[model samples]
Target: MIKIDELREGFGSFWGSVSEGWDRLRHTAAGALTRFKPGEQTALPDRGQIDDPLHFPAQSWSMLGGDVFEDEQRLVVRIEAPGMEKDNFAIEISGDTLVVRGEKRFEGETTEGRWRVLQCAYGAFQRTVPLPAAVRGDEAKASYRNGVLKIDLPKVQPGKPTSVNIKVD
Candidate 1:
């Protein structure tokens, strides 16, 4: 009788843990799916829209995913920008920061057929990437091919030190 009671209690505890884990897993999956829903429309910001200086807009609103790599000579930045033309992007360098701004327009036929799903995000996006070291902004080269934008920023050479003699304090 004691052995049977212990076995039954252990089984009950195991079943309870399994049930709790299943519930938690289900809720986590549901929460992830609810974050981005189909047929959701996100309007693009206007040209003159001013964002808060402290906090920038969310990356979901306008995102241009990319990768940055550096070699002994130059720093290369490659951004994946599909469904866009070369004229849509504007790349600039201010101080030690590199800025890439572009607008991705959504083109779809919504009048003829019933829309079931829409998941692609489109709008104006600005990405500011700071260079690891000083670069020659004027000599920066950019090229776009097959939906990828690549920018090559050459690293600036360290300036030669100059010694000055002070006669009087």
Candidate 2:
């Protein structure tokens, strides 16, 4: 017969292991974890006849990596978000952060059998990057090509200092 305290200890150890693994995965694959939600009907494969070999949950995370470069004149931001049209992306500057939101639509292939593995992530997602210096939001320029979104934001120029003359009383 096993003691009650020993059983409790065993369960605690099991939970601790699970929590530790999750923490490791989260840190190791930070860029590969883009939270997503179900979008239109065509956004995801037909779950009724599809099979997941990796046993991934219905709600899967995607990877949307980005980079920021700054110079004396302007700041440039580049984000990788494939499988989306140019009109689908919406860029905005909120305070000192640059927010990018878009939806990746799914274009179903002409196949007969059920899908065996679905690794690509679909649906609506938003990514934000913090800006180092103040920028001219109204003068921002953006372009998308070959699955990359690029934005150029001009930095705000400082005003000139004015000198004042004092008279002795």
The clash numbers for all candidates, in the given order, read 0, 0
- Off-target runs (Cα >4 Å) in candidate 2 are 1-32, 53-58, 158-169
List, residue by residue over 133-164, the lDDT tens digit for candidate 2.
78899999999999999999898963332347
- On residues 37-133, what C-alpha lDDT tens digit does candidate 1 reach at each position? 1122324333234343432223334235667787777888987777778987899998888888776665655454433443455656667776776
How well does candidate 1 match the true structure in TM-score terms?
0.56
lDDT for residue 9 in candidate 1, whole number 0-100: 100
lDDT of each: 0.66, 0.80
lDDT of 1: 0.66
Q: Show model 1 residue runs off by greater than 4 Å.
A: 1-63, 158-169
The TM-score leader among the candidates is 2
Worst 10 residues of 2 by lDDT: 155-164
RMSD of each: 14.1, 10.2
